[model samples]
Target: MGEENMTKTTTKALMAAAAFSVAAPALAETELNFWSWRQEDIAGYEAIIAEFEKTHPDIHIVYTPHEAKAYNTILTTALAGGSGPDIIHTRAYGSLENISSAGYLEPLDGQVDLSLLSKDELLGTTLRSDGKVYAVPFASQTVVVYYNKDIFDAQGITPPETFEEFKAVAAHLKDAGITPLANGTADGWTIEVMSGAFMPNFYGSDFFGQVTSGATDFEDPRYVTALGKMAELAEFMPVGFEGVDYATMKALFTSGAAAMFVGGSWEINGFRDAGLNFDMMPGPSAEAGGERMVATWMDGGYAVNAASPNKEAALEFIRFTATTPFAQMLTDQLNNIPAVDGAVSSDPMLQKVASFHSAATPYIMLVAFRFNKPTGSTLLQTGLQELMTGAKDAATVAKDISDGIKNAE
Candidate 1:
């Protein structure tokens, strides 16, 4: 062939090589499945997953979120079957026991540096019997009274310091044709939340330590007094509150028809999204000049399934979740108190909520008493519901809890 014809053939060969390169099958990437019950946070998890994949081109993560109510059953069933996702979004405290104790979770202790968390923070993920940590603590939830600033300003009310004053404030709100407290006994868990959020202020700060240490039981006079204080709140709740559900109760507050709501920090994002002007406070002290305390708990965490095929990749992702950047991302995206101590959020409401943490106590039933069957949490919820409905008085309810689960640990 002539020199010009040879040059043309070489160019054709080069173009063909480039096209083949573009069309060739891509290298197989390790696929990791991360399962959680946060179905609403798919976008937030997607952002985190994208960031992880950016530096880890060889690993791909799929976030699978189940319905929150059904998640525990689904996860336990899958794990028991000797098959589950690579990364599991496990609940904290006693909720982690069944999975970890059953050998379904990969013990995360030395594999992931949970050193960023303090010993107290790590308690949420540590197995009680073995002392083996199974997951990275993800977030901390604080329970407080959320008040609508717009209504409070209009009603000329400041946060009431004493239980009597709080009741008076509620009465004032009611007289103005507004629902003073947006709560109902219809939802069992919300009742437990209210009891957690407000009872410490009534029982005094020392009761939690005493009850949890075996020095006292739920039937102690102090606890009965606290339950009595919680029952007093029934009179201040929205009219016909007995029939209202959690969603309707929240709507009553968000729509400005109610003045205050006793709820958790997890409600922050939803309140903000509704454009409601609000602030939160630890509940009123039992008496004037008494110390006020808030209730807090470790929400949940991420763990690796012991049977996962992509264990290394799952560990990489779990380690990433333990980092400050990921914590910050989670805080910014979800407005949560990310469990990492190094992670900080500039959100004004979160900052205020954090301020309340200075005097916070562990959410009583969950942190101290959820490890066994007929958990204190179950008893508290049922007792509180009965107390709220007048079907049981404070003393009876307290005795019921003490009889049911005080010695569970």
Candidate 2:
């Protein structure tokens, strides 16, 4: 052969070798079908998976993001039918009540390294029972008061620090021709915030701890007092709040139509993205200058499917997700504050919210976590709605909630 022909043949051989080297791992990689409730910024998730893939060259990820509203129902149906993702993200309450009882989740106590997380950092009570952590907590969210800076400044109302001051502020806002609170009571969960989140403030820590433990009945004096306060405050809220939905109420605050909104930290991104400047202050105190034990709850975490055919691969996938940078990516890029300590936040709004969460003492509230008895979410919603609509008195509402717990238990 000519000298040029031999050189070309050697170059072709090198190219072929490189191609096979890349294809070999690509063909060898084990695949995991990972599913989530929403597309919810898959780019962030993908970044984590990419990093995991680099480490485990023999593993691959199949990402499937589902519709947020239908994910739970669909996941349950699929699990029953024997076909689902290798790993799934689900709500804490749903996981404990629905998935755990169904035997769909593998107990993760010894499987994942729980010692890396702090007891105070995780949603302390929500993620653990019997001294074993079933789920790896991913995020802790608390209900807080988001207020329009312009409105508060214009009305000369410093954010209310006490229940009495809260009432006066609301009245002042009303007199100033602005709705005091941008509450959307039409949704059931909003009612839950008032009953489950806000009411505990009125009852104080000890009373709430008793009710949560099922030691004191839900109809205790503190419970009634909280309901009465919610009823009284409802009158000062916007007149058309009954017709509002979550998005609408969020818009009301964002657009400056309403003075304040009380909700969880999940909406921080939306508020930030709207480019509307606002300040998140403590919720109006239930007592005069008393410490507010914010109602913070565990959002969700990684759990291996008990019946997954690819159990080892599923576990590898979860281990990678839990321990690796991808786990941090879930919070960092996606704007969630992960249960992992030192999970940094780039968004100033998230940092602000985290500051509030860090400032809260007594750590997790028992009522928020539904600790011992697991407060009936449906019953709590109904009771609060009745109070807001003037359909039930404070004492009657408390009794109904108490009875609802008994029936469930």
Candidate 3:
């Protein structure tokens, strides 16, 4: 009575197991889409993604990077279309605020563990208007001067110790037929980069406090001095310097035709990739042995799209970023300061650039006034271009900035 019935039950059990296996194919691995503005760092990010995949075999990240300048439009269009990447690389401060206010980002405060980040890093991603955090900070950058080490050694000159000596060094380089500063105004942003050093050097630390507090504005005598110092160096730049764009200016220095370039720490990887021997300095002080300062800002962060279908997977990746291994890998590959703790680039130049934070000031236009009407940054950039030409004086530039930022609060 039992033998035939047992065989029939076993056959049915085998057929049921086969059917279950077929249905299980629906549970494929989760894939997270990551969008960024760092089109150049694609390889670096790929290495990062590969490392993360080594542990979480159940999840995969597909990285898609857009041109930095066009990213805003691209992201806005995607979000407006009711579709976007699962993870977004967001700009800090006002830019972050713009999208967060529109509710495009997942509020990250309690969702993502961010104990690895410093207060400043969190503050950079905080939407001021709402007082809530939205992303995990990735990097912070300083605006400092990059000088060709070979050029400096060839001319037997060290970095200047004071403002006057700074000018003297420029004169010396000029006499040696080396373009002293590769910076120029054809790119409006480079002028702002130069100000990162000039503003703190010429105006002193208190100036930011005074200007921010409404006790004074950019029209102060100190700001005029900063603009004047920028103008005074025109003779030491490349011929027809006002027409030199950022790429050409970078070429002048990287090619050894110019001695120095004032730019953001973001330039470190590019200069290194160019095979140039270079180092950075916080521009000189007002007096020998006095303090020096450079402008700095949080570069931005990794965020989860509010409507992401794979939030758990996206957040696991963010959690990996907060780990020391991931932070060090990011630092080593990107050659930029990681916003997380326990990872500093052993690359000496990046280390040196990070050292500027000891005397760093918030990048004035970006950190403070970018949200303002007309934008103090826009006013300063345009004003500096005019100051470099003969169209406007330092005082006039100073007045223009003061007027533009009067409502910048």
> Each model's TM-score?
0.90, 0.81, 0.88
The TM-score obtained by model 1 is 0.90
lDDT of 2 by residue, 1-409 (tens): 7999667545544443343234222334567788777474577678877766765678778788897658878889998888888777766653444665667777776675554456654443233434444456677777778888888888887877887888898899888888888886788677676444456577776874565577888788877888888888787767866777777887788899888888877777678778877888766667776766666666777777788876666666565444425445767767777775434567787777677664352322222433334456666677777778888899998888777667754
Flag clash pairs in model 1.
none
> Model 2's lDDT to the true fold?
0.68
Best by TM-score: 1
Runs in model 3 deviating more than 4 A are: 1-28, 407-409
lDDT of 1 by residue, 283-394 (tens): 8887878878999999988999999987887887887777666777889888889887555689988999889988988898889888997898889988988888799999
- The whole-model C-alpha lDDT of candidate 3 against the native structure comes to 0.82
Per-candidate Cα lDDT values, in order, are 0.84, 0.68, 0.82
Kindly report which residue pairs in candidate 2 clash with one another: 138-339
Total backbone collisions, model 1: 0
lDDT of 3 at 53: 77
